[model samples]
Target: MSSPTSVLLAGGGSAGHVSPLLALADTLTRRHPDLVVTALGTEEGLEARLIPARGFGLRFVPKVPLPRRPSADLLKLPGRLKAAVDAAGAAIDETGAEVVVGFGGYVSTPAYLAARRRRVPIVIHEQNARPGLANRVGARFTTFVATTFSTTDLPHARRIGMPLRREIATLDRSALRDEALAHFGLATEWPTVLVTGGSLGAKRLNDAFASTVAALSRGGVQVLHVTGQGKTFVPDVPAVGAPYVVVEYADRMELAYAAADLVVARSGANTVCELTTVGLPAVYVPLPIGNGEQRLNAADVVAAGGGLLVDDDALTPHWVETELIPLATDGDRLAVMARASAALGEPAADEQLADLVELAWGTRA
Candidate 1:
């Protein structure tokens, strides 16, 4: 009985789903250098590019999302499933993958099915407070299910906080003020706000921020706004003073997190988890869609006094000025929220996921 030398990880579409898989893959490779990690996903997915770029082989499958309306995509589901299984079957045969790990997305469906058909063990890492459609369905077949949220419907799902990159988990807040300011080339003296819409960026969040950008700067705050590439935010009041760092994207999010006294972002599981891991006080505006999963993700922290939740509809300059601005400058309150947020961190998430992966692989060694 040797340790499983190979694994098939399935994920894609959004960075939220793919990032956890990337973290797990990095950890697994470190723990077992000989491990062969293969990804099964559509060529259009972020994984299609990222997996191969990370030196893992990927088997592209023919799978598309089920449309909200009964479209041609839904009509083609049977054929797509067949093609996915065929592709995954070939990849598994080629790589001798002992387990298929599902990270929860459309791409994960076929891999889960393929693994079930091949009688390989299955493990699932569900990153949302509310399980996505794919993970909810995939959970029935999973021998082990890990989740960031304590509350989920999956019978076997265990509470394990989201896995973050090592850098984020070990971020140095002692240099946070100076380092983050320097990283973004902003003033160290002003209260800095880090605004993001999750990995994809949030247009609503950006719009709200833009409306108050000048007012915020006039009130002695510095802004580090990550507007997703190709998105627009119309500033209701023009930036009159030295411009805030208005970038489309920041490649170094760790730096962004490090620099900010407070964060205003979507309450995606990954965003919330990272905020908890790094111990940043935040104003979370959960995306008000899809059964309100994002709201659930931020609710625990908000209830615990670790963060604040704002509905997109309620997001306005008045609210930002009244609530968020004061919180940013209150050092004692920030520390309290930071400590409370840090209390939610699960740094061993990657290792825990690896343990599950090993169990799924059926390797005693």
Candidate 2:
């Protein structure tokens, strides 16, 4: 029998980077049973826990955060980065990695540099519309780049969509609608809207939705609000008349997506990809900070007639009452939006990314 093809995947810190890495790793292993897949991350990153729990080998490198401004940390950056690169080089050698796949994060930078030094092929995947700093640096190491959005400008980038878990990629909302409603204790009769602001929760989303719960309930709409973990701003609105359910966090997002006819949330890359993939229309309130990447994330879906984009500052109770209520109540319009969303979704992204990695591996051999 031929020896196993060894591969190293790098990314970490946030779920944005880690989730896709896991998805691709899952795909690679399933396709080639003998594939030896290992991941590189920082000790402080979510990958430390998530990677091992998924049954993959993981190695950690020192976190070398790039400083945006001159500071004491910036002075230490050169040495820190060199140390990280050396650690990653040791990992590459130990794993006998022939190719390295990178999802942008602190780990990716060192992984890319080490791979280049070792003459190992590098493949990059960028999840956001605007490339992050790590991916930008990593891109120079190789021409193989995959992106979730077509508009993402990276060297030799192909729009491969976001790598999603099996549960989400194959979810049939209609088939599981009843079970989903039961899971959330929601009524099948009322149109349900799922509101979320990711795991950390958006204070603006929470406040705006809280103020408008009564109005939404009055309009015969039900709500499933995920307030994120540790967020404490409870809405003053009475739930006696409204069918409103608020949870601190949702562990089974598949159920929430299955139950929801509409979603009200921020336009993070993963959230937008999952929503569109499931054919769920949304009211995207882009986070009002950063490089305005959130707005760019939602732009294509909204333009394709799959959803609506409301400015963070413009999202108010009155906006929900006037705009969202009518849209949610119109079943015909919702169906149209759902169709548009499904058309834009690339459900085979995991497989496609695995193909890219395989291609890179072949090139190196």
Candidate 3:
């Protein structure tokens, strides 16, 4: 019945899974210094670097990708799954874990299997409106399932919103606006828009915005474009009416959020949550690939009038000029959208999740 002395977290391979794992780890350790938080991930996962950087221990398992359709990989999956589950079981044993919490991903299936085999209580957090396969499987047996979107279809689901890092969670955009503008080397006077396509960048967003730099500058709109690592390109037309800034990555995303009057980006779970968390109006461009979950991620915000969703094929240079530019310049409409965005933000998800983990641990107690 006592609090868990040590906990094992499972999920990785992408920011979608790793970000929330890091957030929850931080919350747990902050609340209980004696609680040990170790992550179970693969060597290829972003967690390899991120988890250790956050001062948490990490264990590795083989990455087992569940093939969507029949293939050679699918045939080999049974063996790979057993190996990963064995590794996950060893990780739990080595840590003497009292409970296991999982954010669904490739690594999650093994963790779920291992934890179940060990009789370790399981907690699940699904970050998408469209549940991923890993989470769907874990949800069947875990009574402690939490979700970001209320519409997320998972058994035993409870809506806890997306967990955000401390920096983004505590950011005061208006208060930090001046410093953010200076940090990004943009004029404080111009209306600003932030365009991003995650760490690897998006060709669609890159192409569409690159073509419209001059048009945006002429309209006195400053642009902060995070073009992802290695996708950086010099704008052919330099800053004239306002600064047209571009960078390979935004190491300090809080500053980017602080400086923006508007955002144009993909509608991944993280992006959607961050925009709503800070009350920033956005033009969400769902990625063309995947299970069409990106479109589902932004549905509530778009319906709430906090953001706009544009099909990937339709977000072009012409559309930016005709639609986005006008919306960027509309101060009255931006204020309304900002209010709606703030209304939908759940700043306390991290704390709320900590409470649920407490409840789940009690089941073992």
| lDDT for each residue of candidate 1 in 293-339, tens digit (9 for 90 to 100) | 99999978888788988889898878877777777778899889988
Residue-level lDDT tens digits of model 2 in 139-227: 98888899999999888899999999988999999999999999988888889999999889998888878888778888888899999
Higher-scoring candidate on TM-score, 1 or 3:
3
Candidate No. with top lDDT: 3
Which model is ahead, 2 or 3, in terms of lDDT?
Answer: 3
TM-scores of all predicted structures: 0.92, 0.96, 0.97
Number of clashes in every candidate structure?
1, 0, 1
Candidate 3, residue 193: how far the Cα is off, in Å? 0.5
Give the local distance difference test score of model 3: 0.92
Q: List per-prediction Cα lDDT, in the order shown.
A: 0.82, 0.91, 0.92
Q: Candidate 1 or 3, higher lDDT?
A: 3
**Residue pairs in steric clash, candidate 1?**
197-202
Instruction: State residue 302's C-alpha deviation in candidate 3, in Å.
Output: 0.1
Candidate 2 residue pairs in clash (backbone atoms < 3 Å): none
Best by TM-score: 3
Q: Native-vs-model 1 lDDT?
A: 0.82
Give the runs in model 1 whose Cα sits over 4 Å from its true position.
67-75, 232-243, 363-365
